[model samples]
Target: METNGKILKAGIILIAVLVVLGYLGVYLLTIKEPVFIKHYIEEQIYTGYQQGPRQVDLQLYYITNAGDNRVVSRVDFPEYPEIQVPASEYGMHGGFMTYTSGPQQTPGSVKGRYSMRTVYLGFSFEEDYYEETIEITKAVIHLSDGSVVETEIGSVTFHFDEERSEVLESRGGSGSGALETREFSVKEDIELIEVFSPILPVIQDSLEMKINGRDFKDIEGMNIEAGETFLVEANTQGSRGSQAFGEELRYLKFQPKLRFISEKGTEETRILVSGWYPIPNYEFIEIFQYLRQKGAL
Candidate 1:
């Protein structure tokens, strides 16, 4: 009876020891550093522009264990240092708006390919946190042998909201190359009146306009009225009498002369005529908005 009791006691002790060892093994495999490691960024935020001296900040969220044992991630930004300009640069007559880039001029450097950067998330253990800092446009995760693995974790992006506005602003210009001019004749018996608005390069330094080989005094703050048809001519500051037309960028004076034929039955009455339009191809005018948006002008 005593031997049987000893054997029973030993059996119970053995079973208890085995159970404890099994639990420890499972714990090590499931929860310890023996398993896979993952690194990832969760989210990011972009702050706006700064005047004169400025710095942009990006916030990133990170996590581990992306469903698999991965240690790297690569991210690419095609639009880096977004192209943005001030309102004044767009040729809008207004207050001063200045936009300047970095000392090395890093604005819009990514030609066909954008600026790039890489993040190196070194080996990580389940208990370890993976980390790095990279100032680049492209990012990637890879094994030591350079095998791309999706398991690697991390996220990177710009503080885009504020910078995005800059790219939207730098557009719009009515320059020399963009205009199409045309001439028309008025009757000798009819009187014609015209007025021009402020010119580009400014009225003081811009092109001088003439009619019928006679230099009409610029009516600043007043309108222009003429009699009959007159030869229209334009010249720049240094080269006077050079009717090279739009060579020098100038603002078309507002309110040009208007004329039209009268009705035979109403010979005693005057013809009501007004308004003139630039004679450029309509298709080109249609593209102005697109060019302005793209900052191409």
Candidate 2:
């Protein structure tokens, strides 16, 4: 009976020790090193035709005191420096708008990833880079233990375009390029005169207008009533006249001489007509296809 009792007590102690060891091992595994959490930004950006002082918003996120919970030493963006601009450098327990629950918030949940310290850095790049897309290659993080880790995080491509510029294509999100409507350059005191073309550049002095899909020459002297649209092509000479005929980057302007009679028997004239549009060439090129075609990856 005594031997049997000793064996039972030893079995209970062994089971308890195994359970404690398993818990310790799992706890150690859960205690992960602070990892960088990069934000996913838009791949397509737009800027003006001309270049000037510009800014790029870059960010990095990480857990400060992860497992052992120690304060982070420093964060550096060696590729991009904060230009002369007033912005937030870094914040503690900030910019964590995602699933952020931990001992402080919830009873027992992991705190990191979405709920992390945010590091926002603004810097300028070369003009050519802004012309197309900005690529992020690497980023460095310095831990509290004086250990430095370099890693790549999130999507790295960014695009730029001016407010006036229009996007012809997009792999990112909606832009002014999505707008397809008959934008009016000039209209007499009429209620429903509009350009028929979905994308009209600008036209000036003499113009080739297509009325209802018919060349204006074919329908010369045709009296266009209200609620009608027409396409106009400039014939006036300008600096961009030597370029593409209807795709010039300059404004086409002229005096609106067309006269209209109102319903109340009053005569009104179109004062002026002008137009200007710059299609964006800031398109995204497929790097893989380009490299494959060039025989150089």
Candidate 3:
């Protein structure tokens, strides 16, 4: 009986030792293994080549891990967010074009700058959307620990057309007959790049205007007040082509209508984009935060 008890005790000790060894192997292989994960960027700096008026390619990129997992992302401007580029600063020969007020043909573009240090990316809105730049209007990023970082996604500003042409809006002079006519000095290549009506559907025919005073025998079908420079465009036949093309739009033409009116009256124009316009300002901290939240950097 004593010999059998000794053998049982020995076997129990051996099993306990084997169990401890198995646990140690697992701990060393997985539980205690150091994970060396890092963020790898293809380019330290990003530049977007100009595509056309009111549109540019953001150079989309993919986030990849050593395991070959990937996520795709691209930069974009907010929908009709208010843009305020001051004149004499962002190269705005014409300054501060807002949805409610500002110069016609305000120039600007939205750009993005990314960083891993912050929870967000950086943004720069410039005047001449064609120029290559490091400045951005939005910034975004994320870290390994699951902490998020980001900033304002993008911005828009106004600029004056250096090549703007002169025009005349006249309604009859000293004449027995009453007449109204618009005259243009030359062609005005006003590019309407983006539109945003957050509160309403993106209506293509919400307003109307006549370009270069070419036609306006009382801009019928509008409820605009006489002597009101604002001409409400009830029909934007010219912009329809752009709408049909959708995201594939390159450029479109617009004849400047001196006046605009909407069925709602007191019409407002909301377009947001980024680029150095009028001048340059280095304000792009908010955009970075936004990018991280969306997992776009």
Candidate 4:
């Protein structure tokens, strides 16, 4: 009985060792690489890519170095979520992508290889209805092995035409020039990109602007709806006349506080997207909290 007990103990130890080895093998053999999507990127950088229920074309390029069985399956854009297309439509007929935003155009000759192939992946929008300029920097690629990849497609813009109009009421002269306020309602959603400050004044100590009553964050771009409030304290220049010889010949000087794009149509305000996410101003936030604690804001 003692000998049998000893043999049973030996068997248990061996099984435990085998199980650990198996786990280690599996872990070491797993793949950990990202898929890639490329375009026939020009010096133009794909400007005015467009909002679609309409079709457009580009030499869809792809690279799948993810794993042994991995193959390009699909490509898509996040900003315009409606657009998605198969990785490659390779058959006896050649190109597989037959559909686009509206019309069908034969894809150019397939290019590149398995490790890094620049094939003409038939591409188009499934359905997108948007207005204004869009910045495209990333593309998500789907792989045949059931994994997804987010790769850079470089900088690009969409639907970038605009219209500008004077719509603010100035109350009095204060901050840098005159304090201006606009009580406006958006007919649709407005995605704000920048707070347009005509002339760059030494504005560090002064409050820049506020939207929906939030305070350094507006420069990062935001979204708003009806009754959206825009408040600015200064404008160093650009008002036709005050009380001078040109008072009668006033050149309606106007400066837009919030530069944005909405569903109704594209309005004025030159756009510059520095970063997508907000870069928090810790000092400003802390100061604000302290001020509110003393009823200073």
Candidate 5:
């Protein structure tokens, strides 16, 4: 009886040891490694001239390894610098409203693409014009590897126009008071390329803009009336190449400024706009297809 009991006890110990070893092996195999995120800006569009809400569109791309490796949780873009202008200038003001987009969710394996839309409010005046460039300095990506990578993208130019009409005796208005209407068209010309190790430039084949504008209210204290509307749009393309691991780089940064100048009764104003975007590879391919269809290639 004593011998039989000893054999049973030994067998139980052996099974327990095997189970522990199996668990350890599984844990090691499931361990995750740091992943590389290739970021790209697909498209950016801005429409600044409108009595109603202006619009801005940003398309972004995120790429990673195709496995249970580390995933991208958050991407931190540099804050757009503040623009300080006096309130008394032009008796008008301009700014942006709360923008909307899908919640920044966890990145999946392979690639993830997203688009964000922002609404802007133009200055309160009969007519307003604006011109600016959107530049992205660098994007700081947080990885499950407990690592952060800063990468440089590029810049793009944008223009804005806002027009309002005074109620003439012909139009329906009380005592020459004009009512604003939402109506405008946008035309854009943009070319963008991803500069990795080997630089290759790709021009945008399509130059037609098809974005419209909507009505908005005065959020800023600029006491401006709503009227006519205008729109802005940018269509871009991107390609990928190998990049060196460590290198000094200069990224496009967002630093917006507004200046009102009046020379000899000629009034002029300058506005600055900046942001970041990521274009997916499929979208880039579609751009080429579009160009070829139009015989632009």
Candidate 6:
């Protein structure tokens, strides 16, 4: 009986030791293992003279356990939203031109000269979160003449503090017209390169002007000779939101002012023109392929 008792006690101690070891092994494997997750964010800007849609690619990458790379999501940020640039209010009759004796000026007789100025502004947030204020660090303008202008004329501020994004808090004044002298002559159809700010996932704003040449005689009893110097001024404002991740767009509203003045500043005329213009829209296939090659997607 004593020998049996000793054996029984020894077996109980062995069983308790095995149970503690099993619990420790389970804890190390299931509860204490280290988990490492990494995220990569990228932004691509597209600014080409092509007639098709313009796009920006915003990609997010997720990696687990070091070598696992996967494209968790892709956002397509279109620069241009409209099928066609917004038409001026005057429907194309708004600039100075030589007069000729003909059958009352047909629309075909008048040639439209378009001047577009695009500003690419970049902003950076203090932190990765959007709750902070955005700072405007870069402002570049592409003129109609293919010349690039850099100025501090206008101010761009983005308010993400609110539920919705509010843009272009203020744009206009002597500073806004800083690129007034740089005008490009456009005949038939011309597309200005879409501007972009890489820091953010969307386009900030845009401005454009259109002038029409008409026969000096078109004006009733007004004697102005051809080749007379004239001043053309265009003031415009427009805004659009990012279309990343197939998100719905909040259509933009544009305000534009067009005017023509004689070189002497004696005569001035204001013509109604449309303010709303098209913004570039993007396609993401190429962007996706590029990122995939970089092992970022």
Q: Give the TM-score of candidate 4.
A: 0.30
lDDT of each: 0.28, 0.39, 0.28, 0.41, 0.29, 0.27
- Compose the digit string of candidate 3's lDDT tens values, residues 1-297: 999999999999999999999678434322111111111111111123332343221221212222211111212333323322211211222222334464433122223322111111123344453343222334332333343334343222222232212221333222111112222221222222122222112222422233333233443443323334322222433244323323221112122223233333333331111111111121334333333333433
lDDT of 1 by residue, 64-153 (tens): 211223322332233322212121111223222445474322211111111111222221111111121222323232332345433222
What's the CA error at residue 145 for candidate 1, in Å?
A: 38
- Return the TM-score for each candidate structure: 0.20, 0.34, 0.19, 0.30, 0.28, 0.17
Candidate 2 error regions (>4 Å): 1-23, 30-32, 37-39, 43-52, 56-58, 63-65, 71-117, 124-129, 163-297
- Report the Cα lDDT for candidate 2: 0.39
Q: What's the residue-level lDDT of 192 in candidate 1?
A: 26
lDDT value, candidate 4, whole model = 0.41
Clashes of each: 26, 9, 63, 5, 19, 15
- Give one digit per residue, the lDDT tens place, for model 4 in 135-245: 556777776677877766644433323233223222222332434333444445667766643221212223234444655344456776654444343322223223221
Q: lDDT per residue, candidate 2, 1-297, as tens digits?
A: 999999999999999999999778445333244444333333333455556656655545543222343434455544544423222323223423334465333211123311234455555555566565454545666655677777655434454544421111111222132121122232222322332221122332224433345543354334443443333333323334323333221221222223344434444333212332222121112222222243322
Q: Pick the candidate with the highest lDDT.
A: 4
- The residue-level lDDT of candidate 3 at 229 comes to 38
- TM-score for candidate 6, residues paired by index: 0.17
Residue runs of model 3 more than 4 Å from their true location after superposition: 1-160, 169-203, 208-297
Evaluated at residue 183, the lDDT of candidate 4 is 40
Instruction: Give the best candidate by TM-score.
Output: 2
